[model samples]
Target chain A: MIEIKHLKKSFGSHHVLRDVNLKIEDGKITSILGGSGSGKSTLIKCMMRLLDSDGGEILVNGKDITKVTNPFRLAAVRRHFGYLFQEGALFDSMTVGENVAFGLSYLTDIPKEKYPAVIKEKLAMVGLKEEVAKLNPSELSGGMRKRVSLARVLAISPKCILYDEPTTGLDPIMSDIISDLILEMKKKIGITSVVITHDMHSAFKISDYIAFLYEGEIMLYGTPEEFRKTDNPYVRQFVDGSSHGPIQMKLMRE
Target chain B: MFTAIGKVMMNWLDQTGGAADMVRSAGFWLARSRFEFKQFVLQSITIGVDSFGVTALTSLFTGMVLALQAGNTINNIFGDPIFVGTIVSFSLIRELGPVLTGVVVAGRAGAAVTAHIGTMAVTEQLDALYTLGTNPTQYLVIPRMGAFLLTMPVLTVFSNIFGVIGGYLVAVYALGVPGEVYLSDITTFMGAKDFMHGFIKAFIFAFMIATVCCYKGVSTRGGAEGVGKSTTGAVVTCIVLILVLDYFLTAILAAFGI
Candidate 1:
């Protein structure tokens, strides 16, 4: 379980995250739902310590990780969480097999002889063929790249998986397939998942709990049913996908 | 105007500090034996073998031009080609070879490092490495640094050899200076210390290029345009610094009687 209390982060005067507080329950799928540039990614980056918080307590399983400055200690904390980048940041220099085996080579004590079998197994788990491993990331399609990135993450067998905009830039069918993969990961691996996304359909489909982040703070935190029934105008506007509301979008024409 | 000057000064200080910090971190990892030898070899091949043709060509032409000009001037003044080899050998070994090789590698390999790492930076592969419990400085910067430091001096030595051959060809064939005189002039006038002066400069220039290029690459932001800007800036800064540093290094080496 991860607990974030009064987290604050800013870039100069531009307050990207302000007073964010939430709890991510263990073995559950928690979706941080927010529109573009709403600090959803920033919140996760801060949790991962990819971006430092201005002030906060990020307690992971009763330990305050925000105060841990030692890189080795931070690596120990981060070892439990697998993060999937928005664009599937696979190493372009490596083959897909090498990419999948990368974390295993660094983070695991597994014998070198077992890497091929493990690579095949992880790629199979992500529904990719063994032959796909020989190809470079540049040859793969957008959806395939995402799966390869997931397979790479799963190679480390982290306790939790963080997905950043997993369903973005995909066909509807591919998006649905990715959503199912997330569910399958939970059912099979039983790992906790935190998904940052603006896709309402995806967030509604796979999330066990949803947090609505608006203007850098959680406007609502509840189940899907509760989110649908919420009275808050911002949450309502976002949930209903309505253009006319108190939450206005800045547009070029405006 | 004062505020603008202060802002520029702050930016300079920030970048200098950042580069120093990165080197320190890389040194820490290196001391712990965290680097991959395979990466070092690969980067060495990329920096040395891939760059040999251009470095040799540049040095060859410079040597030929130096011999041609100096031989003609001596012939017109004293009615004989004199000290052509001495002038070419001294200039090429003690000054031109190291500086030219440094600039060529900076423009070629240095730009490439920045571009490759900059793309990785914008694509979040650096962050991905962190998530995989790997340090980018250890995985990326250290091997490249080792490769540059090891290969730059070797390339400079080759450049010096090729340059002397170029001058010998021009002095003996084009200027009618005897081959024996040209060879003897080089052997008699040039010493080990002259070669040491350039070799030391090459080593220092290698460090500067590696630090500047890696710093620019790792800190790259925005997107493709940012990578372009960083690559250009890295090469330009390296070339300018190589020239600027050569003067100071010459003075220091001279004081030490190197």
Candidate 2:
């Protein structure tokens, strides 16, 4: 379980996260839903320590992770959290299998002889063929790259997985496939998962608990059913995807 | 005015803190690089093999030109053609060989390293490595440094041999100097110290070029345009520093009688 208490982060004069507090239960899928510039991604990044929080306490399994000072200990903390970047962030020079094996090689005590078998199993789990493992990221299609990235995340067997806009560039079918994979991984691996996305369908489909982030605060937090039933104007406006509503798009149009 | 000055001082201190963090990260990477022996060897071979043809060709031409120009001057004054061999061998081994190899490596290998690493950095692959419990500096910078350090002296030796042969062809075959006299003069003129000087220079030049290239590459920002700029900057800085350091090294060696 992870606990975030009184988290505050600011950049220049803009407060990206403001007095935010939340708890992520073990073996549960929590989705943070918000439009762009609503600080969903920033909140996730801060939790991962990819971005520093101005003030906060992030406790993982009853330990304050923010106080980790040693390099090895910090690395251990990072190893517990697997992040699937928005862009797939695959190493172009490495093949799919090599990319998957990268984190495992560093973080685990697995024997060298067993590495290939482990890589094969992980790739197979993500529905990637053995032949595709040898091909570089450039040769793979966008959907294939995302699958490879997912395979890498799973290979580490992380305690928690953070997905940042996982289905952003995919077609609807591909998006559904990714969403299904997310659900399957959650059920099978039984890891605490936090997915930050603006896609309502993805959020609604995958999350056991939903947090609606608006202007750097959790405006509504509950089960998907509770979120749907909320009478808050902001929540209603976002759920309906209204063009003119309480939740406005900050667009600059002449 | 005092308050404004105080703010500026505070900003400078903040910038210094960031720089300290970058240095600390670099130190951590340097330690990690020690374990990646295979990567260092492979990268070294790749860098050396790719620059071989160009370094050899440039050394050959430089030797030919040196023989042609200096041969006329030595013959006009001393009337001994054997001196042409001595002059070419000494100059090639002492200065031209290592310096030319450094320049060629900078243009070929250094720019490539910068561009490749810069692209990885900009695309967030470096960040991915960090998040994956891998040290980017150790994984990236150390192999590059190791490869350059191991291959440079060997490349310098090759450059010297090829350059001497280039001069030999110009003198014995083209200008009618006897082969025996040319060989004997080269053996007599080329001392162990001259060879050692070139090797030392090669090592220093390689270290500087690799460090500067890797630094520029990993530090790059913006995007594709930024990578291009870093590549160009790496090559230019490497060349300038090599020349400057070569002069200082030569002077210091002379003072120490080494």
Candidate 3:
């Protein structure tokens, strides 16, 4: 389990995350739902220590990871969580099989001889054929790339998986397929998941608990049912997808 | 004006600091022996072998031109193209060979390194490496630095040899300076110290190119545009530094009687 207290992050004067406090329960899907540029990704990056928080306590295993400055210690902590980038972020120079085996070589004590079998198993887990591994990431479709990314993440067998906009840039069918895959991973492996997404339909379907982040703070934190029934005007505006609300988008004028 | 100047100074300090930090991190990983040998070999091919053809061509033409010009100037003064080979050979071995090779590699291979790594940066591939419990410095920068440092001196030696041959061809065939005279001039005038002077410069330039390019790449922002800017900046910075540092290095080496 991970708990964040009064997390604060800023880019110069413009604060991206301000006083964010939440708890991510173990072995469950927790979706951070927010509008674009609403600091959803920032919050998780801070959790991962990819971005340093201005002030916060991210308690994991009864230790404040925010204070962990040693690189190896940080890496040991990072090994516990897998991050799925928004665009898959697979190595373009590597074959899909090599990409899947990359993390295994680093993060685990898995024998070199077993890498092929592990690659096949992880690919199978993500519903990709063994032959698909020989191909480059560029040849894979958008949905396939995401699946490959997930397979690569799963190859490391992380305790928790962080998905960043997993369903973005996919058609409805493919989006639903990714959503189902997330659910399946939860059911089969019981791995903790923290998905950052603006896709309401997918978030509503997969999230066991949802946190509505508005203007860099969690305006609402509850179950899907609770989110649907919430009376907070900000949460209501975001949930209903209504344009006429207090949640106004800042636009740059040319 | 003051604000703009302050901003520029800050930017320079920031980049220098970033490059220093990267060098320290890469050094830490290297001390732990975390880098792979296979990666070093692959990067050697990319940084050394891939750029060799262009380096050879550039040095060849430079040698030919140096021979021809020296022959013309000597002929004008003494009514014979005497000492043309000595001039060509000495200049090529002591200064031009290493400096020209450094420039070629910096423009060709160094830009490529920045572009490849910069593309990865914008694509979040660096972030992905971190998530995979791998340091980008260990996986990417170390091998490239190893390849550059190992290959630069070797390439400089080859560049010098090829340049001498070009000078020989031009001095003998074009300028009617006898082959024996050209060969004897090189053998008599040049020594190990002259070669060492250039080799040391090549080694230093190798470090500069690798560090600057990798620094620009890892610190790249924005997107494709950012990659372009970083690549350009890396090559430009490398070429300028190589030329600027060559004078100081020569003075230092000369003072040490290298």
Clash list (residue pairs), candidate 1: none
Q: Where's the lowest-lDDT run of ten residues in candidate 3 chain B? A: B29-38
Q: State the displacement of the C-alpha of residue A202, model 2, in Å, after optimal TM-score superposition.
A: 0.3
Task: Point out where model 3 deviates above 4 Å.
Answer: A249-254
- Whose DockQ is higher: candidate 1's or candidate 2's? 1
True lDDT of residue B173, candidate 3: 94
Give the number of the best model, judged by DockQ. 3
Docking verdict class for candidate 1: high
Across B177-252, the per-residue lDDT of candidate 1 in tens digits comes to 9999999999999998998899999999999999999999999999999999999999999999999999999999
* lDDT (CA) per prediction: 0.93, 0.85, 0.92
Q: Can you tell me which runs of candidate 1 are displaced by over 4 Å?
A: A249-254
Which rank order by DockQ, best down to worst? Answer: 3, 1, 2
Model 2 Cα lDDT, one tens digit per residue, A182-234: 99898888888999887889889999999888777788889989978888988
Off by over 4 Å in 2: A8-15, A246-254, B1-34, B79-82
Interface root-mean-square deviation for each candidate? 0.6, 0.9, 0.6
Sequence-dependent TM-score of model 1: 0.98
Best of the two (1, 2) by TM-score:
1
- What TM-score would chain B of candidate 1 score versus the native chain B? 0.98
Query: Tens-digit lDDT track for model 3 on A1-254?
Result: 89999999999998999989999999999999998888999988888889999998999877889998988899988988899999999999999999999998888999999999999999999999999999999999999999999999999999989999999999999999999999999999999999999889999999999998977788889999999888998888888888867775433220
* Preferred candidate (TM-score higher): 2 or 3: 3
